[model samples]
Target: MKLSFEYGQGLMDATLPDTTDVFIPGETVQDPPFLPNIEAATREAIEHPMGMKRLGEQVNADSKVVIIFPDRVKGGFQADSHRKVSIPILIEECAKAGVSDRNIKLICSNGLHRKNTKEEIRSILGDDIFNRFWDLGNITNHDSEDWDNLVDLGYEEQYNARVIMNKEVYDADAAILVGHALGNPYGGYS
Candidate 1:
């Protein structure tokens, strides 16, 4: 069987090495059939009335909410990365929950990692969502060095795990962490 793959700009014409293992989904698995609807699937995952109902209902209009997202740079770009879906979804849900656009802040969870540039943010979140937050000055970096803006969360007695959180995150009335639940060597369980 022949299949076509969409390669990014630089990778066009690149040939797959013989060591590559290609597995066809249906042929290999005994799972049910798959339905294809790109826009609908995207909306279901990233917009209201589908996956975000619970989160949307819990948020109160009067409270200040900070939505944290993992920096996509750490895990190179993919067509269906959670970083792409989570931000815009949170924004739409926040609007539905009666949260003011100004009160909702989008922050990159860079931690000690390199800061994400405007272009990177735009690439993570499409131009529309990026422009909305960028224009309002609501997007900012997580500066781990700014002690004045960080709060100590005490330490573990056994391992002495010194936990310091971002002030903006701690000070907010509520925090919504939007991250992909994947296994990692860092062992950050949820």
Candidate 2:
């Protein structure tokens, strides 16, 4: 068996023995049946989410809403990617709450990784979204080192972990995080 893996600026092809055990997520282990309409499904989830109020009930016209997305290395990057699809739906929900696009911001939660460039961001967010927010300077990459923009909300001695967060996220009236359900998208070690 042969496979082509994505490498630095190119592909790396490897040949594996037929006896080699290989497990590809959603392949070797089946995922649930695919949603026929991801956009509709996403909207439905937001409308009637469990354990929380609906998205439109969370904010208002004067609210500053920040949508946080994982950096380039995470998630699917297709035009119909989770990031691409879910973000628009989230913005629509915010709109339903009377939040204007002018009051909305997008941040890439890069953590310790190098910042993603405009091209990289555009690829991840798609042209329509990038165009909509880039001109307004509402899209930005997370800077963990920017002390002035970080909030250290006291240390948690029990967990031996400090609760540090980006001020934009902490201070926003509403903050939405788009990430993988199976992965821990928050907190990391330098």
Candidate 3:
């Protein structure tokens, strides 16, 4: 049997045995209802997250915060995207907890993907956030190739390897991850 499936920006034709199984969200299965109010929902989730303390409660004055966001590959940055809405609210929470605006930093966690330029990051982050942090040099993309930009987390006995991460995240007193999660074959993607 032959079928067309989504691949990147378009679709591709594929041939498979008649018994092969194929499933797609909102196609083979019902799509979950869209959130009624994305902004409010995001705010609510952050302020009253499951099992975790409220964002504001975890931070305080003199705290240095690093907010890490997904890259363009993760598909955020629409007008009402979680990043656009949630990030500002997170900043507000930090501010409410007495963290200074200057102490807050935003990082694009690009991982193995190519480093996202400031312009590309702006597209993923929207104007208000991009402009707010960009000029202050508070927004930057992860550069895996830079030794000085990475922080060593020391050796992990369980994994038997050293764990390292971005220096900005390591340096912050409070590190926050802000991104979407997708259920997939790999368990989840963030």
**For each predicted model, how many residue pairs clash, with residues at least 3 apart or on different chains?**
0, 0, 0
User: Candidate 1: deviation at residue 9, Å?
Assistant: 8.4
In candidate 3, list every pair of residues with a backbone clash.
none
Q: What is the lDDT of residue 187 in candidate 2?
A: 46
Candidate 3 C-alpha lDDT tens digits along 1-190 = 9999866547999999999988877889888789989888888888888998888888899889999998877765568877888889999999999998789999988899998987788888888888888888888888888989898889999989989898888888999998766645556654
Best by lDDT: 2
Ranking by TM-score: 2, 3, 1
Worst 10 residues of 2 by lDDT: 181-190
Please report the candidate that would top TM-score against the real structure: 2
Cα lDDT computed for each candidate against the true fold: 0.73, 0.88, 0.85
> Which parts of model 1 are misplaced by more than 4 Å?
1-53, 76-79, 181-190
List TM-scores for all candidates, in order. 0.69, 0.85, 0.80
Model 2 clash pairs? none
